[model samples]
Target: MNELPSIEQIASCVSGYDPNALPVAQAQEFIARFVTPVAAVESIALRATLGRVLAADVVSPIDVPAHDNSAMDGFALRGADLAAEGDTRLRVVGTGLAGQQFDGAAPARGECVRIMTGAVMPPGLDTVVPQEFTRSDGDVVVIPAGAVRTGDNRRLAGEDLARGEAALTAGRLIRPADLGLAASLGRAELPVRRRLRVAFFSTGDELRSIGEPLDAGCVYDSNRYTIHGMLARLGVDAIDMGVVRDDPAALEAAFRAAADCADAVITSGGVSVGEADYTKQTMAKLGEVAFWRIAMRPGRPMAIGRIHAAGPGSKAAVLFGLPGNPVAVMVTFYAFVRDALLRMAGAAPEPLPMLSARSAEAIRKKPGRTEYQRGRVVRGADGDWHVSLTGAQGSGILRSMSQANGLVVLRHEQGSVAAGERVDVMPFDGLV
Candidate 1:
């Protein structure tokens, strides 16, 4: 356990750290500065590494190809044998298949060998003309005048990756392709950062867990399910603590238990102003915390800091107090908690890819606060991507989020946009 700087110290270092009306970017930076990566590493099988973070650089143990090989199924011959003006014919000495090297006598001066893709380039063969390019007359193959030049269609030893070269870097988020890369290097196991255990629950007296009977004026807690799904995508161990009613003792106990068992704690609801919930008070009583009215729409109220378990020398967990609205919870997760959790899990800092899309309709936006509106993006007749709002974008409306494939990001310092104007879109296509 390392000594982390107090939240006050972190805020003081920021240029304009205001708890009220803080810009989205500033809040991101403040959280980034305060959170630290977990220092545990474990070696796991390649199959289990998807979404895990690499703890160390992976250097290639051997050349990728290991030897000069053929990249196409063709006839292998010396480049000089290729005529510059007319066709050149050569005798076929033998045939080589992939993984079966040609072991017979090397072709004499005017001879060639038929080779398949992945077959090791035989001695003295420096070029491969696609089998389709050459005409077969009896046992000889004819090459056209300009079919290929020296080194055409030949994969050299270490051409793709050299031995001892860094193949995969540290802090890389493991994807399926990365697993293939590691497997190509003959790695059965990979060193990855241990997954962070995160505990989360909903805070509201009117909230009920699924399968529980809904009372008058109460709703089921959907934020936990969303939080669980999001955490699963990040490859973290998510602990759903269910809903905590507006009781001080229960809230305090939940916070302590969550902190004691996990690296971070998330609570959706009861972080807003003038809420009769005891979540805010319980958080302050446990550890260092600050509430922020972030300058963002769809999600604004946020609490970030650390909370420790009961007893001396207790481990502290990073806290993320999100707003109650179902849509607000998801929006705030993507904007803030996603990055913070990635950092805590020891993954590299990677911004979600945002693409440009033209607006299908006029959108009203203010300059100071950032707004994320649910949008369905599609290709317009002009062949460029265009986005239209998902109907009824209230924060409590989860159906609007379900209908959206992306968030039309109207950035801070940018105002209203007219139809056909270009805007940035944070797509959800590959976030899974």
Candidate 2:
């Protein structure tokens, strides 16, 4: 097995890489090297399928509506029977309603049938006159106007979707509209990818769980809840392993349990090189560390590795150790674990959406590192988009995140951007 790389060594290895590259490019490289998707299928009811990836293509088994019908409440008539101006009266032979059909042939010359919306058109009827244009008088109907066009106000069967055609392809995530479509096709269930199981924990003797008595130099454990909420948003089945004190034996036991039961394990606050940080040591004992540091702000101390099987018939579990700071934990997850979880769920790669906006204020940045500044974007009166930062860029302030609707991306080589300069803005709602 290869020895674990030190933080300095990992930085040296990737030092020459471009820092101006988009987040997607950086994430793809990491995903290709460290992520392996599991292949499994499960049957889920249509009501519960939203956000789940489809394991197979969905083909429509039946035609929508299954028959030609009327799109409006009108009088069904043969096109030839339409009279010129000054024509006043026509005979009404029958009526058509939804779920009930007029079995008789279409109306003959100067004859018509009353039809309601969604009612199947009677055989031989090629046109329909709206009820507003006609008057009824005891077995007599009046169509007092110019000629009406043929095939008007009628809906054709299978016009929306053809039978046996692919309605949705594999790897598409199901949405509310998609579920409605499946219901229209009469599907009671769907085949979807099984949810990925994730296990996560927070490490530090200075942290206390919520509802527990506070002690000196102790803060309530927050990373665990933050990770749990983030995973919930991604639709993963996340298990909270609670907080682990800075003890090697306790950490080892937690890792063993997570490796035995979960596809992946995540921890925060113990991967850095502080004197009390035992997580890196334990990780070196258990498996090879793939990478330990990245050339980015707020999330520099991060680790990715795999835990070796403890015994026969056991499989390795991917492990991620993130920085202890709350903001850093979130940024690292969005920059790394989000894509890994998506891949593990059998989802196809999707690039985050980006928009161009003018900066509303001046931005200062160095030339060697990329920065993600929280920003608020709004459409100006001229219909152009503009973005401005949400005040301070401190890595420890979680409040800044709540005020931001998107991220203002600063390139590696760019020094300063003045107001009204075009910049890339990525909306946070869709990405994480």
Candidate 3:
């Protein structure tokens, strides 16, 4: 195994380091460099490969389709049979169905064969005319002179995938289409990376898990549940450690336990400056964690580093300390932790595409920080995509996030946006 470089080395490589005003791209690059993917592989059934990372490249064993076939229910005939400046007619010698062959010698110059969709082409036939384009009269079919060109509507052998061609590359997350492709290649099972194990918890004295009676000064803990759902969507093996109170010993123990078992640890509170909590202090004692005031609204405070467990045979886990606010936790997770976890799970880097849409209303934005506002995108009467804020943009307002289908991303150094201006949006659903 290659040893990972320390954060100090990574930071030194950065041209300039600003602890209080880090750019989103810089932070992402540092984190990507610091993370190491898990090195484990397993063979699983094709049906169970969905969302799993492919460990090895898959090469096709045979040609797809295996033979020249008609792509439509058409008449398979010689291109030379097409007459110039007039209609052409030929005798329909025989019929060919899928999985059945035309029983005879090659068709003559004035002869054509009736072929169905996916049926292998008859010998010496190189073109197909759709059945609809031809008129049949007592085993004879007539076709217009300019109907089809040579090799039209005919799928040649090995057209989709040739024998010995690489079908799927390594380090790819198997999706629905990938599963079908593997099945078509006659593969019963695929080699995939083992699922990444991640343990997460919420840290706050006033935080309570579900089912606990509401106290006078405390609120229910929703960060843990939200984090759970987010991790589940990433297909990671999650270990929810419940809520860790604001006690030094309790928080340290939780960190140690999490590092001992999981490949990574995520906590949703206690990293902000001027916050009266022991989560940060306990984290420092247990690991090498750095608290940062990122130049990003809604999720400015974050902690990233690695924590080590005590004694021999103990393992170390990467730490991600996100802000306490409900929406901030989600924003930080999607922007940072999501890709980090995907990398640690042995998946290749796949950047999410930012689509542009018109803004429905003016937005108040400053110049020095990145902001992610919950937005609902819709098609306007002008037949163009327009986006408007869901509701209140507070980091604690979880309802806005629930109602939003995407986020209007305002990058650093960008000023206020006017109505009808094009802005970048990151969608919540669809291809990641």
Per-residue accuracy of model 1 over 1-432 as CA lDDT, tens digit each: 457888889999988999998998899889999999999999999999888999999999999889898899999999888877989999999988998989988777888999999999889999999999989999989888888998999999998899999999998898889999999999999999989999999988888888999999999889999899889888899999988888999999999999999999999988899988788998988888999999999888999988989943587899999999999999999999999999999977788999899998999998999999999999978889999999998999999899999999998899999998999999988662
In candidate 1, which residue pairs clash?
A: none
Q: Give residue 277's error in model 3 in angstroms.
A: 1.9
Give the clashing pairs for model 3. none
When 2 and 3 are scored with lDDT, the better candidate is: 3
lDDT for each of the candidates? 0.91, 0.79, 0.90
Off by over 4 Å in 3: 311-313
Q: What's the TM-score of every candidate structure?
A: 0.96, 0.81, 0.97
The stretch of ten residues in a row with the least summed lDDT in candidate 3 is: 306-315
Query: Per-residue lDDT of 1-432 in model 2, one digit per residue for the tens?
Result: 444344334434443533233233453465445667767899899999999988998899887768888888988887776665576577888999888989766567777788899998888787778888778798888777673577888788898778998888888878899999989888899999988889999889998999999998899888898899889887878999999988999988888888877888899888765647688888778875644455566676777777865843357778888889887888888777887888878887687688899999988877655567888999999999999889887876777877889878776566788889999988887665
After the best TM-score superposition of candidate 1, give how far the Cα of residue 80 lies from its true spot, in angstroms: 1.8
The total number of steric clashes, by the backbone 3 Å criterion, in model 3 comes to: 0
Alpha-carbon RMSD, each predicted model: 1.5, 4.9, 1.5
lDDT of 3 by residue, 1-432 (tens): 566787788888866767677887778887898899999899999999999999999999999979999999989999888887789999998899999988878999989999999999999999999989989789889898788988899999999999999999998999999999999999999999999999999999899889999898999999989999999999999999999999888888899999999999999999999999998888887767777888898899999988888733357899999999999999999889999999999998688878799999999999988999999888888888899999899999999999999999999989999999999999888622
Point out the higher-scoring one by lDDT: 1 or 3.
1
The C-alpha stretches of model 1 lying farther than 4 A from their native spots are none
Q: Which stretches of candidate 2 lie over 4 Å from their true place?
A: 1-24, 76-92, 109-112, 126-152, 213-216, 273-276, 309-313, 379-385, 411-415, 430-432
